[model samples]
Target: MTPPSPATSAPTPTLLWIDASAGIAGDMLLGALVDAGAALDDLQSAVDAVIPGSVRLAAHGVTRAGLRATKVEVEVLVDDPPHRTWTTIRDLLVAADLAEPVRARALAAFARLAEAEGRVHGIPPEDVHFHEVGALDAIADVVGSCAGVEALGVTDAVVSPIALGSGTVTAHHGVLPVPAPAALELSRGWDVLAGGRGELATPTGLALATSLAGACGPLPALRPDRTGIGAGTRDTPGRANVVRVVLGTPTRGTTDAPVVVPADAGPGGTPERAVVLETNVDDLDPRVWPDVLERLLAAGAWDAWLTPIVMKKGRPAHTLHVLCGPEQATALGAVVLAHTSTLGLRVTSVVRDVLDRAWVAVEVDGGTVRVKVGHRAGRVVQATPEFGDVAALAADRGVPVRQVLAQAQAAATAAGVVQGAPWDPVDGGPAPA
Candidate 1:
C-alpha cells in the first residue's frame, strides 16, 4: 500500500529561528529585526514611548566575516542618567503606551534580566540594580528588539545552541568570568557553547533570547521567506560576529489532524510537535530508577515512565519512555545516557493535541491548594486537584487527601474558573482569593 499524501494546508502559526552561531546581543537582535524588514521608525517610536526621547536608534549596513549585515546603534541623549532598578524599569514599561503584545514581551525580557541579576547579587528581583544594563541604551536595545519581534508577527521562536565566548569581562561588580554571572544565570537550563575569546553573549542578549525562544535546537525544516543578519560591534578574525534570524513557516508533511482528548480525561497538553525518547534497561538496579526519573524531570522531560518487559534469555527488563519538546530531546537524552545503563536510545518526533488548561489555587483550611482545570472546545471539562498540592494540604490540615482534593475542586467550580481564561502558570503562581 502506498503512504498517504502530506497535508497541503499551511501551518497555523509561523516560527522565527535565531542562529546564534556567531553570538547574540541586544543591539544585534534589534539590527537583525530591522534588516528583516521591521521599520526602525516604528521600533524607535515604541522605545520613545517608554523612555521619552532619552535615546535614538539607528541601523547601519555592515559586513562581518565578509557577510553583509545590519548593525544597530543606540545613542543615549541623556547625560549622567540614573541607573534604574528593576522596579523602576518595570513601572516604566507598564506605563508605556506601546502595543499590548510588544509591551508584554519587552517587560518579560527585562524581568528575566532582573531575575538573573538578582540571582547573581543575592537580592530579590525588585531590588536588583541594573548597573550597565539599566542604562538608557541597553533599555532601548531591549525594548526595540521586542517591539521589532512583535511587528514581525512571529508566533514562536526557536534558537540554536548559544555561543558564549571565553575569557573575562569587566563589569560594575569588577572583573567577571566569560559568560558573566548574569549570562550564566540566564543560560541555566538551556544549551550553550563556548567559542571566540571575548564576551559574546551579554546579559541583556541572553535575557532577550531566553524570553523569546520557545524552543532551542537547530533551525527547523522551514521554507524561509526572509533572513536577517545582525552584526556585532567587534570583528573577530576567524568567525562571523553576527546573529542570524530566519523567518519562515514549518514544513508540515502528511500527518493526521491533532486528536483533542476530552478535558475530563486528564491535563491538556502542548499543541506543538514533541519528541518521544525510549531506552531499555535490564542490568541496572531497580533502586536506581527513582533517582534517574527525578533527574530526567529536573532536566526538562515533560513526562517519564518505565514499563516492564521480558528480554532475551528470560531476563526481565524495563523500558524507559521520555516525552519532551523536540528542542529538549538532546539535553534530556544526555541525562538518560549518563544516569542509566542503556547503551542506546530511540527517538521519534510526534504531534500532540492537548486540551487547553490552567492552574488555579483554592483556599482550604487556611492554606492554598492548586487545581488543574482542563478545557476542550472552550469549556471546562476536567478539574483535578494537583496531587502535590493536595498532599501538602492534607498533611498540613491533618485531613484525608481525598477531602482536600474534593474541597479544592468545589472551590474552583464556584470561582467560575474555566479553560480559555487569562492565566499564566508561571506568573500567576497560586491564585489569590
Candidate 2:
C-alpha cells in the first residue's frame, strides 16, 4: 500500500509565471498550457458556458512576435465592439457563476488594472474605463486560469523574481514606456527585477498572476508534478520565452526552499523555524472564539485551534494553539489580544521536517478524484482521494458512495494510477470516495 494518502492535504493551487524574456498575453498563456500538453478542452468549454453576451472561444497553434506557441483568443466578430465599465464587467462575470473566491480574485486583479489606467489617464477607479483589459479575451484569461488550476490538480503556485525588461511598447492608447502603468501597479508589494534587456512582463501577465498569487515572496520549494508553459508571442535569443507552470508540493530542505521556510517536523520540532504562540484562559465568554480565530488567521497564524482542558481546581479552561512562520508572530499576537480574554501569550520557534508532496487525478468509483501524492526524491509515498469530490460523484450516480469509493480504489490500483497506494477504508475516511 502507498505509505499514506494525501486525500487529507489537498492544497489550494499555486501559480508560477516564468517571464518569457520576451513578453506574454492572454492567448499565449492558454496556448502554452495546451502546447505543453495540459488537458484544456474541458476548461475552454466551461469558459464558453459562463461568459455572458456573445463570444466564441477557440485555440490555435501560432507564433507571436517570432515565438512558437499556441494563442487562445475570443472572436467577437461583430460590426462594433461593446464598451464596458468596472461594475458592468464584475456583474456579468458574477452572473457567469464562477467560483466565489475566483470571482473575488479576478475583480481584485481587474481593480488593480483600473487603478493603473486611472492613474495614467488621471481618473478614479470608478470613473476609469479599462477598455482593453475589460474585454472578453481578458476575462477568459482570468477565468481560464481558475479552471486550468482545477484541471491540472496544482496545489502550490510559486513565482520567481520578476524580470520587467527594457524599452517602450506602443499600444492602442499611446506609445507608453516599458512595463506600462497598469503592469507597474499590479506588481507592487512583490520583488521585481527590471531591464531584462527587453519588455518582459505584460499588463495581462502581471495583473492576472499577481492577483491570484495573493502573497508575494521568493519561489518556494516544490517537487514538480506537472510542467506547463504559457508562451508569449515573441521569441528572443536566450530567455525561456514562456511562462512555465511547475506543479508540485512544498516540502522541507530542497534547493527551492523558502528564505524563512516552514518546517515539517511534528508539532514539537515544527515550531523550530515557525512562530509558536500559545495562551490559556478560563474567564473569557465563549461567544468571542470565532472572532479570535479570524483575527489570528488574518494576523498570520497558519493555523489556530482551541482545546478544552481542566486547570487548577478543575476550573474549565481552553488552551489556544497558534502555529505560523517567523514572519507572522507580531501581527498574530496583537490580533489574539484584540479579540480574546487572554491577557498575555507565549511565543517560540523550532525546526520542522515535512513530507514532500504532489497531486494526481485518480479515477476512483467511476469519477475522477483529485489525489494528493506526497513524495521523497522520486518515490510516491502516499495518495488519497478527497472525500468532497467522491461525495458529490456518489450523490450524482445514485448509489452508495462507499461502494463507488471502493470501486475507485480498486480501479486506481489496477490502472496503476497510484502505484503502491494504500486504499483508505470506507469506515474511517469517508463513506464517499
Best of the candidates, lDDT: 1
Q: For each candidate, give its TM-score against the true structure.
A: 0.59, 0.56
For candidate 1, which ten residues in a row score worst on lDDT?
1-10
Q: Which candidate achieves the best TM-score against the true structure?
A: 1
lDDT of 1 by residue, 318-426 (tens): 9999998764554466467556878778998876766555566666667776666665544555667779988988998898989888887666666655444433343
Judged by lDDT against the true structure, how good is candidate 2?
0.59
| Model 1 stretches astray by more than 4 angstroms | 1-12, 132-134, 253-433
Q: Per-residue CA lDDT of candidate 2, range 307-330, in tens?
A: 998899999999999997553454
What is the lDDT for 151 in model 1?
A: 80
